[model samples]
Target: MMKARIHQRPKSSMQSGKAKVGQWLLDYEPAEAKRLDPLTGWAGSGDTSAQVRLAFDDLDSAVAYATAKGIDYDVVRLGANPLKLQAYADNFK
Candidate 1:
């Protein structure tokens, strides 16, 4: 069975306007083992699911997609949105 995670995107550390903060993301955990390349010694997995990231406007849509695909997912809820408004001019103060 494939394991997935559903969560909201974390706020940017830059304290910019919350333009894309409301989006939710669905990510899959890798079910494959990483193999080291003998030539370059680079480690990587062949699992394409690990590379897929589906974004949704709402939490329900993210969960619904996971259910339709038979994927077992864990929803991680983020803390309340940050309310500390900042301004570029404040940096100079």
Candidate 2:
């Protein structure tokens, strides 16, 4: 079984922006099924969307398959590409 996790946070310290981003993530469902985290306010209701996705596989073959399809790395090492979030969602299916 494979799993993908997506997280979204406000882009700034504005209630409106946080609400907007939260609503967007809540309503937007990518190709892969995802679980949304509870709405959390930081810096006193900020306006920013800090999102992330984690994809897991039990076997190397599965990881290879995901990578071949352009899936991003799960580990957050140096020089990690944020664009890989979509790739993870793409493989969620």
Candidate 3:
């Protein structure tokens, strides 16, 4: 059976803006461990499904799609969203 993971897009560590933070993502799990090519010395795998990523607007849709396709998936839910309000002047204090 195909295995997949469904989770929300994480907040960017480089920027503060929360744009597209909640978008759900479906990613296939790697079926086999990557092996190093003896000739080129490059790490690669034959499982191309691991490269596919499907975006969903919400968790429900992502779950539905996985169920319809008979894919075994695990949903990773994030903790409660916490917004900390602060002022620029507070940075100096």
- Local distance difference test, each candidate: 0.91, 0.35, 0.95
What is the C-alpha local distance difference test score of candidate 3? 0.95
For residue 12, model 3's alpha carbon misses the true position, in angstroms, by 1.2
Query: What ranges in model 3 sit over 4 Å off?
Result: 80-88
- The segments of candidate 1 whose C-alpha lies over 4 angstroms from its true place after superposition are 80-93
The TM-score between candidate 3 and the true structure equals 0.85
- Counted clashes in each candidate structure: 0, 12, 0
Candidate 2 residue lDDT tens string, 10-37? 3454442433333111111234434454
TM-score of each: 0.79, 0.20, 0.85
Tens digit of lDDT per residue, candidate 3, span 9-58?
99998998999887999999999999999999999999999899999999
Q: What does candidate 1's lDDT look like per residue over 1-93, in tens digits?
A: 999999998878898578778899999999999999999999998899999999999999999999999999999997765687689899999
Candidate structures ordered by TM-score, highest first? 3, 1, 2
Best of the two (1, 2) by TM-score: 1
Of the candidates numbered 1 and 3, which has the greater lDDT value?
3
- Which ranges of candidate 2 are over 4 A from the true structure? 1-58, 75-93
Worst 10 residues of 1 by lDDT: 77-86
The true-versus-predicted C-alpha distance at residue 45 of model 2, in Å, is: 19
Ten residues in a row with the worst lDDT in model 2?
21-30
Query: Compared to the true structure, candidate 2 yields what TM-score?
Result: 0.20
Report the Cα lDDT for candidate 1. 0.91
